[model samples]
Target: MDHLQCKVFFGLVICLWTAKISQAYQTVENDLTDENSLASSYFFYQRPEYPRDCQEVQDHCSYTNTSGLYLIKPDGYPEPFEVYCENRQDSAGWTVIQRREEGIVYFDRNWTEYKLGFGFLATEFWLGNDKISCLTNQKKYELRIDITNSYGMSFYAIYNMFRISDEVSKYNLASLGEYSGNADTHITWCKINTGYENCTCQKSCENPHECLDTCDDEDICICPEDYYLMERLCVPRKQCGCHMFEGILIPEGGVHADSDCSRLAICRNGQLRWDETYECGNNEVCEIRNNIRQCYCKPGSIGDGADCITATDCSDLYDAGFTESGVYNIKPTSWLEEAFEVYCNMSDGGGWTVFQRRIDGSVDFYQNWTTYEIGFGSADHEMWLGNKKLYHLTKQKRYTLRVDLVNREGSPYYAKFNHFRIGNKDSKYQLLQLGDYSGTADTQSTPNGYALTYHLNQAFSLWDEDNDAGSSNCAEGNHSAWWYKNCDNSDLNSDYHAAWGSDASIEWYYLPGSNYNILYTEMSLRPF
Candidate 1:
């Protein structure tokens, strides 16, 4: 090769080698914001097999091109595991640690139950002391999660229960108390649904070429996770019960009494008999309910009244501000009214105001007045409302509120009735809006910043909704977050919360922050 040619060839080779290595070593990580995005692997708890604690917990593991912190709940060891400092996605076998982001990625074992506190969704099926049981598609089964502390390790375990529309559908499910001895004795015991222990270390190989005669993984071949395997061969797993499983199988026809079949046994013609255990249908929690053994039931349908609703209901709850979309409305109660004696004073310069029972957050609008009264004063006598005292205005009531003033000479603020908190007593919160019969409420306007409308840039790319983007828009730093399309969903977690961008149509009014100790009557414009 010529000298010039040699140099070009060498450069090309180096570039190809670098690219190949990058491809082999990179992994993608993102914050787990959407509950739907979590994997089944995350919820699996084959106690007697895996401890059920978070594994990507050391730091946020990257998947689908985002980075986030993860944590387990319910006071197991490592109470608040500060998972990843910064989340990054680098290739597998690659050393890309320095790219970690500076935020938290969390694992929410508690999310399942957190959705239930409202008492509107499924009730009474949750395992452990907590109650937010998710019903899987299987016919006679229910699934719940329990987070427990074991020797300082956080164990997130799932409880599988049985259900029955017919008296026959119910089963008295039981599990072997996880074997407590060393791997040698192979001892075990029975208990209800709880506590997972590693069954034993299996040497089954992932690569067939590497198998030493066993040609399989040592895992107990649990359902769902093991659905890919049939007779130990990989296949698809979905929702339901089929072939058969061990237990006193429900007879082919309708009958109350148990036959000869035992859990781990099967049913052939019309009888409960023994056969190698097969995968139970979807939704089955692998328990011995009633006098039955190894039977299954759909999740959330313990009895006649407890059945889970269809997928339609699930979507409704998912949309019900659970994602923290806009400014959530706060309701008003009697204690709040008693706490603040709202007054509009033209003589003492009190102006118009809505007082909260506690430290006022901010305000949006005040009814029963002119539009002129809600903005900043254009003149000295602009008779506009003021947010002078957040904590203490020396009033008869403790007013936690949002005060609005028109055309404020200073920075403008925007907030909804949902933003204020009221009452040291009752918590019947309500947003003081036009109350369904919409009416005009004076609005406060402010100077604009590109803060909400940044163009395509690196910052935009950083907030990619899909991993498909290689070249993209995204700006750097904290300011870059709001510019994206879904910042509301992305930033609503309590750990790293950011108020979503606002739409001017909402007409926000809320009290600004209080430093009453410094200046009692404070006013500021907030639009978020």
Candidate 2:
């Protein structure tokens, strides 16, 4: 061949070789991205695609028997989806994307795929369609196409995806249908520093500072073995660092002074005191109770101690603010009913929802057919006579029984309980499912096959808020009294006042008392 003719031939060969290497890398990348997206559908922001490959047709992860594609993602998502070829038939062959009954499936002539991106980490190009074509006979053709990559992906080496994406995005949708290829989707080639890439990737690494892992302070040491980086250096495991209880947990990044080494503490993702600990304002102790440490009421300083453990607890529960009718109708439901359905009214003279004791000293919650007392874990509820938790009840031999709360632990502090039927230990089945909750005394086993030894009240601990180191302004709180060298009543009382122990504080407020026969308005632990 002449000099020019030989050069032309070499160029074509290099082009073909380059295409194969790009295709392979893309195949693997698409697989991983697809996998991550399948794993996270709800929390992530998935991009749009005209996916025609098996990757797009269905949600395999969600189905009983289907899973497809896995793609490795970068720290984040890609700015744009790189489109490789102008639309073209895979040299030759076919592919199809379809929905059969409940699922979407794909039949392809070539092996094509899509990838997904995560919100965190490096940005990856996410969401794409793999239009593949198999050539039983060697051939290639042009096709039209559109594609986007919202999931950002990273390769151990540089520009792996930047170059690979070019070969991956191309297909003639007009001609391709699922599983219509004559040849299986297999493209082959190799090497990252080849000619086709034209070294577009070289510019990327020119600035070392541009690398994702690059940090301003190389002097800062890497976190030691088990320890991880916080602001910088390695650190030991932190203890549970909760600052509030009876509310949702406030996360603690690491262990700090003033926290007790209570409960099993594990440092997750460098968070030493995460999902645990209760912190007190100024001077307070994070007390551990029932395997959980919550903010206790400081000596004399009291909070209902109902929700001192969770962030959810700190929030106020306004009346549905009105009636089921929609406005201005605040009411409470009766607790421990014996034979009547009494309700507390917010409009009543006495704000308290008082219960009317029956002639038999019984509150008929179910019309006297049964008598019950209730119990509670927290003080955030529509308290019957100022009490939500009922400890005792008087029920005649065999009568209809029903506790009147819709959900167990109707409030944050209450224990969760639905009526249980008595059962025999050996039987391993509910002997009676509380038909009207009127089952016979179970001599065989406990109600839930659990030893029927402790009552609901006795099963849990009593680290009331009155014994903590100190208190904060939040009302009805439990904490310690450190200001007082000793746990003295006088000092405790004084501290309570300092923390706003009187009514009007958000933590505790006692409404004026009036005598009335309403059954549902008081705030305590009982369900309304």
Candidate 3:
């Protein structure tokens, strides 16, 4: 005991036997973080003689910190067991041990092992036991633990075991101790902070759209009706004007009235002004009627009080009267007077004819014939009054040629009687080319007379009376009546003499005035 005090007395008895084995492993890890003998062995192994019946709870008990464990018990109440810890660096750790009769157990840290047995360990058991054999049958048991440390620092745990009733009510070896880096076995009941994860403590939100949920205890940010908090984001409430127009919104200082109130527009901030004292009067023309903003008149004009005048007149045919029966009602004052003058006091003799038209589709008949010579030049041939040769148009009789055209010149050439002939006065005959009158109202009065041998010799060869028998070549022959004007009366060989074909030459002092001529026309010949 004297060699340096015998090596300092065995190094103080090996440092007091290593401090009494580190105070007996810190008093058995502080009795597994004491909870009063694990809550009285979990209510003494789940009282009611527990054979797993919490009414057999099921509904796949919920848990999800990223899908880890679930052990249903919906209404019988077990649903609160979820523990996940993944702070990051390749974090890996998990453990779950359910066990009603005896089913579920999984452990991992890559030491992977899983089991789920029931009623007699349903085919598998030992999940690397930390303390297995618990529920001898008085059911109820649950344990979920997840610890992540490979520098990913994390931890979580949950344990409940309200039943097990058998083998000495197992599982209290200080509740199967294992967590080491103790800050008193640190648990702090989970807390993550930012988007929450078991956070029973730290929470804060500045303006994730004006508080989308996190900061409470009055840290404020509850904005939902028409929103409003700017910097912290909840926005949505600045209307001021709204102005749309075609899709019609127009709101702000709103005015819009106009269907006679002339037009008063408004809509300020979104811009759409128009009231200059309710406009539209210098001949008026704004438009857009029923849905507002209107003025009126501007279509050939005519509205007077608020201004608009120009509609000149021209629209009277007495509503188009003479409805059928050789239809005749002629009136030509002046929508430019196309051709006039017709006095056919004829039972067979009272003439005076003028009727003209020519913009190329020729039509004329200046036949004074007996009222003393006014027929010498532009009447190439359409004249067949009646009684002259005793109603002489016969391919076996059927005639009703009524012409009551008024004021129609060249706008599609009018005034009928295009070509006519009836033999026996001339002989070779054959020049029946009939009328193809022009538009703006015409009535051939066809009760049945338009069928003269199906239009004899099919119209338009005018006069081939045996090739002009006594030839004045009838004005350049080959069937030429010189396009009417002074009457090229085709002599059907000797005595029929009917004429038509005049596009110009009726100058007995050029009898008509109006610019394009042909103002009124009326010719009638009947023979049914």
How good is model 1 by TM-score?
0.16
Residue range 145-252, candidate 2, lDDT tens digits = 211111111111111111122233443333322221211211112111111111121211112122223334333212222222233222333322233333323234
**How close is each model in CA RMSD to the real structure?**
34.0, 26.0, 31.2
lDDT by residue for model 1 (53-144), tens: 12222223333133232232312222222121122243211111111011122213364443332221111111221211111111222222
Q: Candidate 3: misplaced stretches above 4 Å?
A: 1-255, 270-276, 285-290, 300-528
Residue 501 CA displacement from its true place in model 2, Å: 48
The runs of at least 3 residues in candidate 2 whose Cα sits more than 4 Å from the true structure, single-residue gaps closed, are 1-82, 85-286, 289-352, 355-360, 363-528
Better by lDDT, candidate 2 or 1 = 1
Evaluate model 2: give its lDDT: 0.22
Q: Give the TM-score of each candidate.
A: 0.16, 0.20, 0.17
Q: Using lDDT as the measure, which candidate wins?
A: 3
**Backbone clashes under 3 angstroms, per model:** 116, 111, 44
RMSD of 2: 26.0
